[model samples]
Target: MVSVAEDVAIVAFEQTPSHAHFNDSEPAMIMPCVNSVIEQVGMDRHDIDFTIAGSCDYLSGMPFAFVMNIDAVGAWPPVYESHVEMDGAWALFEGFVRLQSGDIDTVLVSGSGKCSPGSYREGFSLQTDPYVHAPIGLDPRTQAGFQAQALIAAGKATERDFAEVVARSHANAKDNPYAQLSGDLSVDELLAEPYVQQPLRRLDCPPTSDGAAAMIIARADKARELCDNPVWIRAIDHRIDSHHPTLRDLTDSPSVRIAADRVGLHDGPVDIAELTVTYSPEEIILRDALGLNGETSVNPSGGPLTGSPFMAVGLTRVIELARAIRNGDGGRGVAHASSGPALQQNLLCVLEGDG
Candidate 1:
């Protein structure tokens, strides 16, 4: 086998199929998938180099819900591990960063969320500044509401244009069993749907979903040794914005622009882009920032709109894109993730095939 000086590659990944009633306890949702991911990747729990997870405790109406969920990992005897209450996509970044040391070989990275409990809008409000912003009951969706207005004002996009995103995501989600919303609805039909928060229609917002996804990453040589097909990560990085969306330019995503540029996304035409835009309006911002035209394939996996299970949604984007590369779908692909209100945070990971 080659040495660890080579790039890292994904060995395997798995995400729970989105469902309406995942009434099972949080650990129940995590256990089966954890067992499946390790098996699919042909690795035993003892073989894991490290572990990291992401989840929102508010989703289950408790503090440190991830504590009990650790049982799913069987991470007894003190495995090198960590957790993030943020999106799993961000957690994946943490794992990727930690593996920079060659000493760590294969990692067990997963994220989960159960959105069926609290009002997503109310739960999201907690992300706002507690002192000044949270008191007003301002929700993240409300920020998107205003962003919808800005796009219309700039003539950059319109309600009808955003509706196209919803329609396409839904149609694509139909092919994705892990997707939460998959049904037939024409663009024109979606345009007529009522708005959930003015300017942003019901279809524009991602459905509250519960899901978990796992990815196995190994140093390039270990990857080659494990799988016949390997997707090598050429570049990866992430950025975060101010907590104050009002203090920032809500219409533009500088974080995305810088992140994609860090990974050289604008340098070439991206064959496939798995963008974690949870809202239809944010999709426009991501595409514009990436300088991607309609020719480039975007979100063939249905995206966050189809099945955003909170924390894990972002990590799932990376797993989906890596799967494409390993399957020989293309020479290169970019997976994008975001967090905070109205796309305030962004991460870019570029993967290339051996070819």
Candidate 2:
């Protein structure tokens, strides 16, 4: 196992339902989750040593949009706070690192996004290299399509496998109260559906969603006192591959492999893995990269395919994994999150129960 300088564990977590349109302000969407996590830990707002949030102003369609979200976590009493332009998962990463310095005992990490007011395809396209992909209007769906085609060409996966991923996700989502989509579906029926982007059917894509998530983590001593069952964070690591899609192999995820190894994903048994399979084909690539087999239950909460809330989706992966471990669903687990085009960047976190 990867050695850590200090013991850290997640004491509490909460998330809003994945909504197509939250019909409220971003702060309104975030406040409840923030309140719930604090309540879960029975801690006062001022008790949290640090607060960090992740969001995108472009997605919110306003400059300084994230500044307004601070209201959700409460800014009164002048608490120490920070923000990340990326996902809430990255904010969690920072919090995890800060706690290791032995200066902080508790931290709150959160992320939220509302995609109803903006064009995700157009907005996300700007994340691509301006001179090359952006001007050409190359968007994420098309990028995913390219990746799926590469998997087929490399003989790593087939369209049927993509269907199976979606089918399983929908089936498993039936048990997740926070999931936006859930139902039993057959792979054969899913494969018959028309494609949204060539080779990727509509079901293959994650629905555009608006949601928020928050989690409170603390050092070993504080965590033991705060909660009877804290999910210990064993190791965490993130890695990135070439940004330019052409320069990397799309059939496999090198970044995931690196992060998984660094986090010691296989040093012990993994009972469950919440992978960020934003696209159906991603499950295939990630499954192989992480070396997860049928014995390891993957995406028991249905993962991003059934409920993707953009900036918060990655953090939600961690929440799902932690919840499973806390509830005795597993003894150990690994959570995965990805950002950028075609899974260019990956983050992995390993967690274990008190058992």
On lDDT, the leading prediction is 2
What tens-digit string does per-residue lDDT give for candidate 2 at 1-355?
4679999999999999999889989999999999999999999899899999999998999999999999999989789999999889999999999999999899999999988888988998999999988999889989999999999999888999999999999999999999999998988889889999999999899998999999999999999999999999999999999879999999988889888899988889999999999999999999999999878999999999998999999999999999999889999999988888789889999999988
RMSD of each: 2.7, 0.9
Estimated TM-score for each candidate: 0.95, 0.98
Give one digit per residue, the lDDT tens place, for model 1 in 48-162.
9888888888877888798887888878877888888888777777777777876788878788888877788888888889999899988889988888888888888988889
Against the true structure, candidate 2 has what lDDT? 0.93
lDDT of 1: 0.81
- Cα-based RMSD of candidate 2: 0.9
> What are the clashing pairs of model 2?
none
lDDT score for residue 290 of model 1: 85
lDDT of each: 0.81, 0.93
Clashing pairs in 1: 88-311, 89-315
